[model samples]
Target: MVLLPFSARNTSETNDWNGSKLKDDSKHYKLLVVGGGAGGLGAASKFARKLPRGSVGIIEPHEDHYYQPGFTLVGGGLMTLRETTRKQEKLIPSGAKWIRNEVVLFTPTQNMVTLDGGEDISYDYMVVAMGAHLRFDKIKGALEALETPGVCSNYSPFHVEKHYREVMNFQGGNAIYTYPNGPIKCAGAPQKACYITDSILRQRGVRENAHMIYATSLDKIFGVENYVKPLEEVAQEKDIDVRTRRNLIEIDTSKNSATFQLLDENGAATEDTEKIEYSLLHIGPPCSAPKALRKSPFADKTGFMDVDDGTLQSKKFPNVFGVGDCMNTPNAKTAASVSSHLKTLDRNLTFAMLGKKPYFKYDGYASCPLVVSKNRVILAEFNSKGPLETTPLNQGKPAYWAFLLKKYFMPALYWNGLIRGYWNGPATIRKFSRLVDSKKRQGVL
Candidate 1:
């Protein structure tokens, strides 16, 4: 659920929350889920129905659930933020108990989690899906500058709408977009912001007056070559300057200047630096696992939960598992990847609960829909082995149909199927589409 506030009446007062307030300020459950975003909701839904009522417990302090992928469209002015959100009470599965608080500590050794307000919870099996936190504080002046007139970001709900406003307010100058270093969700978002900005400027016929530039820490425009070639062509056609190995080190809001620390292909900073003054700046901030997860016994040194890349089960404790952005998997972090993660966890975690070794493996699948134009998208889908083509048509090119699927179809599926633990991503769709294509090619209709 999107973390936000609601009236007291709308919470425990309106309905009977199944979570108990024990005499020892403690609770227990057969299964516990920390964080109520996509992964937590999916996990709770998967197992709760099979077990008795109140068997699953989810700890999340939120009132509204957000369809996060829609944030990009919201920021681009194609959709409204309200359209991406739903009441958390309505979204949490019927059988699962929702604890409206955050976990302060995770104790995998004792199979317990300590929550704020001094409540302790013990579970037979636990799934950590707390995901990561954005740190605008990472780059000096970045967080503080978010309130400044010309600076904005799509990463936070509080600021996503500001991007459209900033772009619309532009009077013709440098419009700069940045991709941060370190791990972050939605790797393609920075460039999406760039493209959205470009779309808005071109729509306003102010493209000639503005310099659309993208500054990224990555060596390439995109990870998969199948989509990168098309993205490069889009960049060339749009006249968007795509600068690689340039990290946004500092944002000087007062002077409307951004500082970039140049890096070599080897990923080290050099003595050379470049500065650009901008009218509107959109930044993708650096991110890491939540503070509690980072400080917990389960987390790796880099602050991600240590889990087997194949099974997604905790390396230290077999009864524990991880999904989504919280795990130290090498896969690209995105909600599209969450479908694959949750699909694997729903199967493997249940087997683990039965005292069986998980035989399932998660392919590092991910998708990124690059909004190259108003009604066009370059859909990229791939796994560890490289591009895993899902659709029958060549998906490397930008198409309005892809954009329509992203803009309309995805949100509906996410709300109706994904949160209900029924959707397992487009892999099946890919296979079925391939089968249909095969029949057509063989004239077996």
Candidate 2:
């Protein structure tokens, strides 16, 4: 493939594209990646190294990239917002061409995408990794409430920093945290914020005065049953009132109250409504795939990229695949899931390019290091079947080492390993740990 030099024309259509010249109205690549988040960057990095230079292209709109898992730490006062961010340009692979724009239209049937700057991008194969969007506006007063003093959300970078402040400033009253009624990245994050706040309040001698409540749409404390028992125990020990089937529908900033709609076991909303006055409110906002994918032909009814659950390939378009939270998969939307799913995506996409049927299947693998306190975390690892723990220790119990890993090691792994295509989840590590365990049992030196 021949790489064209960027033109110097200052056309209106290419003005927002960072002044990068378009050789023509359309450009083609061997492989194209949408979004520069964990999944996109990882897959692009893998193919960029495999394909010829300039054959791989990535379309991303943002200037900054974030280590999103660190947001929980930031809200817990364990990490700063700046520590979780980096320049998006620096993270792109050397062999990949970066298209600094967002996709306005996705035409998978034509193997083409139209950018916001009106440039057409076509590729032999495409990977959609646009990730999910936090729809805070879904709740009636969420946006306005986020600007207020006591209302904050770890899901939003703008308001994440305020969570620590809100926890510290709380004198006494109801400290309410909410979980929305849809798929969200890091399903464990909502309670992480609450647990951190409980730790901080107890340290400040305010735990006795505050009534801590966790309101979630789910019927259980956690999806994975192996981890739920311990988490419920932790909640009970921390004196947190865990209310299931309660979803935050609105926030009243003027009255310092939050309204929750009660749901039945089937997740259907009932007419009963409960309003609780709060000293501080932390919301895990509802999330959805990007509007471009939602409106596209390859979208599922839930507005996510329509792909086969096990193959991660578009059902209708064989050349199109999905990675990360944007895809309609049964797994929890976490960066760890991206790391594992990308392994399946990378192999399957490569096979598709070579006109071979993909043999590898994604097991819906996902991990969540549930931070239950300041220095304790329950590392929950599982797949569609059940608990797929990496270590020999019981992962359902809170451990200090897991806390340290979540707080420190995971961030470094994300920046240096995952997005660079060097990490392929914990399968290798899990295998190694099992080998060691067997050796130990046999008394092997």
Candidate 3:
């Protein structure tokens, strides 16, 4: 198979794509990847080697891929934007075909996907890892607030840089941070941004003027208790006022106020909506899978890819698999979760191709490095069976080591090891750690 240059590929239809320079209007491959994020690119890059050259086709529009987890540190002024990205052409496996375009339609019945340019790419097997995206426009007045000076979010690349600048300029008074109403990519990130801002304010000797407030749509501070117990202590110790079950409804950037809806036990907003004044506002926008997949037979009622929680295979289509943030599984949608799921997904998908029963199991392992301060993090690691701590020590306590791991090593692993499919997750360490077994029985390692 002859390979074309990256510049020759149709990255987008509006941008100089014409059949005049093409050999064929359509193509077929053994494996097709729908997204270029951590999930699709990682799986495609790793599995491409197992197949012949040009057997894998990946649909991605962006030229630069981001290390999303590092955005938290970027917001905290601990890292730069350059540290969180890589050229897309460089990361694509040498053998795989890069279909540099966004998928406009999913036709599972026919085993094909249509690109925005009206060309259909057929595949024997496909990975539907179309990652989630921020819906800032869904929330009333959110887009304007994102463009404003004091309001910022770490959720988007365009706005994350604004966060560090906002924190530096904040003279202080009623600084508010919000966690969105539904399942977010990183549940801990919104609060992490708050803590980092608070730390910066303290370090700059302006803590006396700042009233740090954290409001979230989730009922609890965090999902798991092993870490929640200590996080509550940190909140109280730092005087960061915490309010739960409150979701952002609207923002009044002109007056520096935000409106929130109080969710009842049923998760429906009651008649009352409260508005509060603010100086600095950080927003975690509502997220969902891409629209095309949601309309296809692959997604659930909530616009998430419906897949077997254990196998990571689609319940409806045997040839289809879900990965990354697009999956309907209850696991936290972090890169760490994607790493764990891909390990199982790779094996299960391979088994399906071989017409064998899937033997490997994905136990819903996911980790969120909660950056409580600039140099400390509570590494929240867990599965369906409650807390599955990686080390022997109480992981709830914010440790400088975890922070260092998040700051320095994670990006290297993501770029070098993870996309290569060599690094699945920390599950092996969690299972084999001598400290974990001894500490559980003796209360100390």
Candidate 4:
């Protein structure tokens, strides 16, 4: 196998290969994907099957691939951490070359990327799907508090299982659930774990002793208003206190207390400071694109890849595109969104390679399975404008069918249809359902 070397020094000035002062041959690829996560793998798999074997390469450091959506379930005691991860080698398509190294720098202007191991790779087209970085340490006292009892987070696979343990061991007092201030991958997950804990406590006959509180920076239960009313009702019925515009600032683990700062309507910090004691605390840490991307010139002001909202193409560099949580697209970051991104990126990138106008556009489609209880789920599907329900039945109302779809059907669809690039969300199915509904209404009239 031919090995490439990388250098932090300016590569344009130096010319050496294998200890020889020779000009490095810039290797070109049809497609280069940066991450090994869901979006990257989905895009790579699709492109690999379409492009020739040697035409595609994936730069990923980790050897293990995680089904991150399952982390919420793991925290809820419905799944295990071991079940959420798979060998990265098994997930990458057979034809695509996997470069087991992290990208240190992305030079979008030159169509090149530098790896941490001092290797340089050039591509004709690139997809940035590095995803979001969970910054647990960003919150004051979070890291230290996590080391102590009565504190946990489900955002990472490493810490998800600890959530259940913490919940089960709680004797009595406030059980706090926190949602961070920024965009979080699987937006529904943090609250889902809270609901599960509530259910578990109810089943154990300890619900009366434990006070459940959801402190979120956002004012609404959900971004899409269709599910908001129902979710609010669920919280009310479960006696879960919902506090909006409350941001977690510090944790006094010794005293088992948490500090929160209230924000005004404009999101400015206010004078109000609230402190509460807790027996169990579930934190959803602030998330952003990886630090490497933040430091790169390719990133926007928000430290995310600046991509066109509709086309998924980089604004500064036409040859570069972004998918998943790494891009500054105003869509909920989820595995379901990545499935939509894969289709959009695949078609647009191919069009760019052929020097033709891109034909496809991504409407910011994303799905969030709001697991309200052990046996029910509110399958929230929406696009940029608003809710786009796929099923003909009332999606706002939680149903057993939605629960089954989320637990059993969605995972299978993700593994088979999404990972393979066959799934482009449920747009066509949704359209068909709408057509059928129209026909049924006409007949009734």
Number of clashes in every candidate structure? 1, 0, 0, 4
lDDT of 3 by residue, 60-126 (tens): 9999999999999999999999889899999888888888999889888777788998988877678
- What TM-score, computed on C-alpha atoms, does each candidate reach? 0.93, 0.93, 0.92, 0.92
* Clash tally for model 3: 0
Clashing pairs in 2: none
Which is the better candidate, 2 or 4, if ranked by lDDT?
2
Q: Show where candidate 3 strays beyond 4 Å.
A: 1-26, 435-445
Give the clashing pairs for model 3. none
Question: What's the candidate order when arranged by decreasing TM-score?
Answer: 2, 1, 4, 3
Where is model 4 more than 4 Å wrong at Cα?
A: 1-28
Determine which window of 10 residues in candidate 3 has minimal summed lDDT.
12-21
Write the residue-wise lDDT of candidate 1 on 100-121 in tens digits: 9999988776677888988888
**TM-score-better candidate, 1 vs 3:** 1
Top candidate, metric lDDT: 2
* Per-residue alpha-carbon lDDT of candidate 4 for residues 2-44, written as tens digits (9 for 90 to 100): 1111331113333222233324433445578999888888888
User: Which of 1 and 2 is ahead in lDDT?
Assistant: 2
Instruction: Quote the lDDT for 62 in model 4.
Output: 95
